[model samples]
Target: MQAWSMTDVGKKRRENQDSTYVKLDHERNMALLMVCDGMGGVNGGAEASRIACEEFARSVWDTLSGKISGKEAVALLEKGVSAANMEVYTSAISDPSYMGMGTTLTAALIVGEDAYVINVGDSRAYHLKRRAKDKLKQITDDHSVAGDLFRKGSITKEQYDTFPDKNIITRAVGTDPQVYGDVFELKLDKGEVLMLCSDGLTNMVPDMAIEQVLKTSETPADACQTLVDMANRAGGKDNISIVVFIKD
Candidate 1:
């Protein structure tokens, strides 16, 4: 089991409001990966992401033990997200500066041969099977205006790329009293890869290019650095963060 995570304040952003967490249980071949992208003013955004990422990771770690069933894993992931949302929402209400702070969260838990995922807002989860060719599957849906338009076939890929409101997300954690996460369960055979990332990478790097790097990179660390570098080269415009793990 191997995992790597990286975060960068992109060329155009004054601060990096992205946060990530990775916990690997080598003995059990289990790993937990999470990424959060915050939206708000400088302080609010950063704080929101930090709180959400930490709370979720901590909650899961507290209860995670040896082997478990798929159903139990999904319930634990849901509980973690709920705990994170409540903490962020509470902090937002308590502080005037963070009144409207919120963040997008994408989390994946890899246990044995299966991966359980949960997502809120625009951050995403992706899967790539080592034996498959050119098949990089996106596992989460974006809760943003442009994302909705593109999914509904109301807009072309070109239009979505240039959409003025592309950055405006419709759903987020900590923005309201309650937030629901989308959950998914998938298999992760040996040598397969699972990734969680903020929008900075997706917005700047095309999916095909991302798939190419994942296919060619030798290790999770290499893939992470290469992707971040590529995003910067493509005119990094936001905070970029990625978490990648491979079942070796």
Candidate 2:
């Protein structure tokens, strides 16, 4: 297994509210990748994203503290996500400055030949494979109004481009007492590629363009830099974060 990740503050943001993590379990052959985009004021947004990334990854590691199956891995991720939400929510309510602090979290766990994805809010996960014609297969759905409209077929592609609420996420970590994350499982082939990213990359670059980068990059790190650069070139309106991994 191999991976690369990057986070940027973007052109307009004074500070970055994005965070990411990547770790590999050599013994169990489990790889974890995550990205978080925070909300609230400056300190709150940064802190929220930091807590979610650290807590969620640690909780997941603890849940699989022992041996687990693919199904159990998925359940563990769900439990970890809920725990992370509670942690953030409790922290937000405890402090005055962090009143409405929250964040979007997207994670992927690859064990052996199976991969599991979990997401909340607007951050996303994707799967790419050469056998799939070099298309970026989006694995997570954004928990936002635009996402809902796009999914329900209520909005046309052209309409979605101009639709508002694209950034108004319906669900988020730390915004409520509880938040449920969506989990998906897939079979990972040797050359399959996975990406976990914040809205920064998607909002700036189209999927087709992203797919081209994934296909042409010589290394995962190169792709990571390329994506960040692309987003920065496209006006860099928000904090950017990306994690790219490949099954080897």
Candidate 3:
């Protein structure tokens, strides 16, 4: 497998509040990827994402130290998300400067022929394959007001696109004493691509455009860089982050 990741402070953001991580183990044939998009006042957002990522890495490292079954892998991803939430929540309450800090968390774990994913807030993961027209599939759902409305059939596709509060997420790490993440499992195959990214790229560039870039880019790293550059070119409205892994 091969992987690549990149994060950038877009044109409109004063500071980048996104954090990413990627771990590859050739011997074990395993890979881990994560993306976090932060929200809060001033310095709070940046620190929240940094703290969440650090906590997530520690939990993943400890839980995935040895070979684990599919059941254990699912449990491990949940633990990682919970650990990150607690770390950010505790820090936010303990310090006045970080009173309302929170962040979106999305992770991808690929081991053997299986891939596990966990998500909170609005950061997402996508599955891309070499296929006919529709090559990119969004693997996670947004945890936002707009998302909920759409799921309940209260909003139409046209309305969802113009929803005024689409940016307001209903669930997030560090926002409450207890937080839960949506977990998923996928059966991966050779040459398939799994991408984890912050809302920066998704919000600025549509899914169709993302597919075009992923298909045209020559390498994993090139695809990642191209995604970031494309988002920036489209009047970058937020911090952009991209992490992708290709099963070989």
Candidate 4:
């Protein structure tokens, strides 16, 4: 497995509030990709995101280094997320400057031909599988309030298009002491691609556009840049971060 990642402040945002990490345990055939989008006032957002990513990476690395089964790896990922949440929550409470700081997290771990996905808040993990006619299909759901409203038929297509606060997420890490995340396991095949990104990219570009760019790009790095460029062209309203992974 191979991974590439990129981050941009975007056209409108003055600072990047997003952070990402990609780690590959080649000897164990394990690969991990994590994306975090922070929320707060001023620098608080960036700090929250940085802390979450760093803590998660450290916890995962330490836990996976010990003797454990594949299932244990999944559990460790969840534990790492919980630890990160507590760490951020405590920091926010202790420091007046970082009050109410929070962040959305989404991660993917690849072991052999299987992929494990963990998500908190609106950050997304997408699996693109090739289909007939050389097409690709997306295999993840957005976790935003807008997404829920769209699914429940409460919001029409026109309303969704113009809806304010469309990026508002219903769940996030560090918002509360206890955070629950969605976990998924899937089988990976040759030519399949996994994308983990902040809402900034998704808010500006649709799934089809993402598929088109990834399909045409020569490498994951190019695909990531194309996506960022497209988002900035479409009016980048927030910090953008994305990681693209290809399974060999």
lDDT of 1 by residue, 99-212 (tens): 999999999988899899999999999999866454899999998999999999999989988899888998898999888899999998788889899999999998888888
Q: Kindly report which residue stretches of model 1 are placed more than 4 angstroms away from their true locations once superposed.
A: none
List candidate 3 stretches off by more than 4 Å. none
The local lDDT score (0 to 100) that residue 101 gets in candidate 1 is 97
Q: In terms of lDDT, which candidate is strongest? A: 1
Worst 10 residues of 3 by lDDT: 61-70
Roughly what TM-score does model 1 have, to 2 decimal places?
0.97
**Candidate 2 TM-score, true structure as reference:** 0.96
Clashing pairs in 4: none
Instruction: List, residue by residue over 1-248, the lDDT tens digit for candidate 3.
Output: 99999999999998999999999998898988999999998888898999999899889865677677888888888889889999999999999999999999999888888999999999999998856565799999999999999989999977987799888999999989889999989988887889999989988888888898877777889999989888999999999999988888
Candidate that beats the other on lDDT, 1 or 2, i.e. the better one: 1
Error of 3 at 35 (Å): 0.2
Better candidate number, 1 or 3, judged by lDDT: 1
lDDT string for model 4 (62-113, tens) is 5666445669867977988998899889999999999999999888878778
The sequence of per-residue lDDT tens digits that candidate 2 reaches over residues 91-203 is 99999999999999999888888889999998999889956466789999889999899999999877776676689999999999989999999988887889999999999
